[model samples]
Target: MSTLTDRYVWAAVRSIPEKQRGELEPELRGLIADTTDAQREKGVSDADIERATLLELGDPVRLAAGYTERPLQLIGPRYYLDWLRLLKLLLVIVVPIAALGAALGRLLSGGDVGDVFGALFVTAIGVAVHLSFWVTLVFALVERGGVQRIKTPGDGPLLEWTPDSLPQLPAPAARRQSLVELILGLVFLAVFAGWFVWQQFNSFLTDADGTPIPVLEPALWSGWMYWFLGLIVLEGVFAVWVYQRGRMTMGLATLNLFMNIAFTVPAVWLLLTGQLINQEFLDAIPDTDADFDTAMSYALPVIAFIVIGVAVWDVIDGYIKAWRSRNVSDTAGE
Candidate 1:
């Protein structure tokens, strides 16, 4: 009767040994039914009753832990190394890139040093929050049994942790996350950031009337402009980092995938709100008699689709590179 209860039971049993599922499922269901019925005898509504029942069972992951006789740490000793490796990898790769992008963007825009540092400070915090939240969440899922850990370096029958056994050594092919690529990426980032900032400051492109119309309408977005620029800078930085790191790990790929999503979703929303393009530019097109609203209806969806496609490709590309890097490593090892 309770879908929530069913979901909870399934989630709790999912991480345990499969042979135990048959014995546990019915037992779990009966337990849910009893709890729900008892609550129903009181004045609790169906929703609240369902919530209470699930609460009594505790966290689904922890419950699964109980069944499997596993400890309930956010990440167990078995996975701590992998989790830490990923956390450090992302932080090392993401933070500097983000900060540098912000610094470069702010500086090229003729912003003062204080403002540039301010931007860097904000970017660092933003990147750290993103890394911390996602890394913790992934490990939490792994803890709950929703995620499975892949073997890391030195994971063998007699594996023991040591400074000499540190997983910092990337596979031979992974070394392809080359400095040359990073330098090239930095150039591209600088150009893109400079271009956008230039667009913000000047309107070199004009209609037949010789009147200047800005590429982006400044006033159309009162508060969102800052966020949009930040997004652009964040993406640029992420690209720089990705290009530098020839080898990608699963966690790193996943983080980048979600970063692309996080960046795209809000950007798409802002674009859909009809705030992305300048109305003045649209109206000023000498040959086109189309008004702002009419032009938007025809153009926005196409633009949004393009943006979405690019974002999706970025996410996929990260994983593809990771796969290729792994393949290269495997071949070299053989």
Candidate 2:
């Protein structure tokens, strides 16, 4: 009872292995050609064949989906293994560099550089020796998907991939990006730390009380804040890279969310308490305390606002990643 066009399309599907049929989509043109040839030979009209083929193929939207690979995510397949490799490489390179820099910085600043560097170098070598042990342990944990065996039904024990499967390996592509990001992050952290240390040291050499720190006029502080905020934004972007690479474990992800929440929760509590006491400024500083308390009240909110803003961005990123992961699961199911 099958029409020529129906048989033609079936033949195409039949020629493809069920498992790989999803990858052979756009090549289905031959099916139409074969159907046309058969219809011509039988003297069946072209119009009839076209109508029959359209009906046999069902909806194009649904058919097209059958030919595509399921999405792989949480960390996407392309980047998961890469992220793992990156983390390892970063630990090896950055830790030593940071240690050496710290030592050099101390020595340069009159703080026992040689002794500290020597001790740190020796400790690093020890770490390298034991590196394999730790690497193997981490690898084993990743392979196990960070979970114990689950109970299953029937005659034998079973292990299987499931929707809730944890990401253990870093995608190779993501690992490369992570390495680049790590290098940049270290460079930024180093520069900032060095400047900070130097500033503090200079401040110490001068009179005490920190010379009132020149109350950074609006233009100066605003410019500095712009750069600082930019750095924070960059860090947030890199965190997304990790999330996309599936480097975020549920425990770590929750902790990240919790820390952000904690940073903001105090602000809300202060407002509530301040309103309750009907006091404009709480604990109105006892000594020259008035000046100190006033400074803190002004400074605290600004710092808190920056922290909360960054934290909110991080939370949004986590949610986005979680959503993408769920979609990947659904695609795999399909």
Candidate 3:
């Protein structure tokens, strides 16, 4: 066989089982030769005939799949929608529960802010990976086993698809909104980064010697501040991803949820532990009849409440926006 025929045969059988390749390679080469010969009889040039024969045979991957009677995709059309639906549902429901459990366990075990945050992050990621792997493995097996349908309680038959089941594409207005959100999120992160740096050199609070004292603990610069900034950058990247997609998805919403938790839990913990604010800045405050600690004891709960409330609201808002963007009636005539 010519070099072109050799290349084509190699590609086609490379992915096939070794035992089968022995049989398939010769047959494939023979087929290509026969086709080239037939084309040559029609006065085609040798190179042109080889190219035409390869083109007519099409992609090697597909040809190999045909020979093996195996699918090229992990999960085929038969279970794709069902797999996606189940995966999204599990990510939304299970991830948050896992995060909460991890956070609570860390808190109960007297773990510090970093420990709790780490636990939450690791648990969420590990659980999500496990869920995805097991769910996909199950579906792939079912697909290969030739199972036609799955019946779920309250969901009817999984195999039956309808026009009503089609996902609604985001409207133009929704795309515009996502753009606006992306811009605002980037701007906010930029301002936050600037403010964090600025406060280290200049702040309204000053010591007895008139030196500016950062409102945030300077000690955080050692490590925690970098983690906080990294989260901010991640949030900005996520915003761009959402805008590029032109709509919030369940996975994005779940990510937003974890981001919120990651930020808020540490913040609330820092505030409660008196580790968030500068001790020197606190000491510089003019004395009052009420001690600062007493004042903060009453104030910290309120501050924590507001911080947590905002995070919770943001998470809920993301899910709502995702739902609205995906429901046709929600954006109709807009």
Candidate 4:
């Protein structure tokens, strides 16, 4: 007469080790059936037998916990220390390599090596701070049973976590998060724009003569190329903001990313090529003007193509995002 309708109990039954599940199922079913038979013979009503059987088994959640041997916590105390240790290891290995490469690049390119080194130092700290913040949050949530919410395909049956089991983030905290993102986005855009302008200014000062500067400087002609980089970076920032705000359509965001890559490839290619050709390197001598001209003729069109492609993509991507957001707003209103 007794039946197991609780999802947690059923999930636990299914979660037993494959060989164990096969054996446990028959035994548990026999016990339930035998208990019901005994209860009926004792003159207990069918409903009472069912209720008593469930009661004796205790809370389904606790019972399930016993059967499911897998760890249900994502970042428990055991993992937290391990996570920090791994992160420290990564920082030690990656940061110095990045710093050394960046410092060497500045030295070769005739830029401020001290400034580049300082930037590397800030970059390392920034990376650590951001990674630590997210890791700590994951661990905090895991401490409160957050991992149980993740149901994978291999999981035999669903055991849904109730509202009481879910993490509750406060409205003030959510608003503060929004504010922080907005500030960060603005800061990124401002920094990118500033860099673009500075490059253009330096190029203008050096391009006074028709001849190429002794070193690679973004000059009159090269100043135009920086626009391509600026457009790509700006579009990227906008796309990211829209994504975080949940206003970005998936198709449009993908398109934006593609546009960014398209713009990025040629500009970066030319910049790298310039670096390789510059007299500072151990390449095959003066690198004939004919070779440079040949390279430019091929490179300019590719850069132009990417620049145009990005422009068109940005306009289209922006319109698509606006359209989708408007549709969502209308649907919500109706």
lDDT of each: 0.64, 0.47, 0.75, 0.50
RMSD of 3: 13.5
Q: Over the stretch 1-334, how does candidate 3's per-residue lDDT look in tens digits?
A: 1244554665677667878998888878887888878888889896567666766665554567677887645577445556876998888789878976897798789986588678878998999999999999998887677665535433233644322222344457767876787788899999998899999999887777888999899988876687688889988888888776656876789889988877887778878888898888877777844677798779889999999999999999999987875554333312
Using all chains and alpha carbons, the TM-scores for the candidates as numbered come to 0.47, 0.32, 0.61, 0.27
Q: List, residue by residue over 127-246, the lDDT tens digit for candidate 1.
A: 999998998887767556644324433322112322111112243443554566666766876786676667765786676777667777666345446655666677667666655443
lDDT of 4 by residue, 22-64 (tens): 6655555665677667778888886577655555554443354
Runs in model 4 deviating more than 4 A are 1-175, 200-216, 219-223, 229-233, 236-248, 275-334
Better of 1 and 4 by lDDT: 1
- What candidate 1 gets wrong by more than 4 Å, as runs, is 1-181, 204-211, 220-222, 239-246, 290-296
- TM-score, cand. 3: 0.61
Which candidate, 1 or 3, has the higher TM-score?
A: 3
Report the poorest 10 consecutive residues by lDDT, candidate 4. 161-170
What is candidate 2's lDDT per residue for 1-334, written digit by digit as tens?
A: 2333332344345434577555454356665566557766877776666654444453332233345544323333333333345546645464555544554455446554245446456655666556645655654555446443345332111332221232233346766876776667667756754553344334222224434222222232323333334444545564655544555443334445644543344334344334212131133224536687677677666666776787789787666656655454444323
Quick one: how many clashes does candidate 4 have? 1
Report the lDDT of model 4 for residue 94.
53
lDDT of 1 at 26: 86
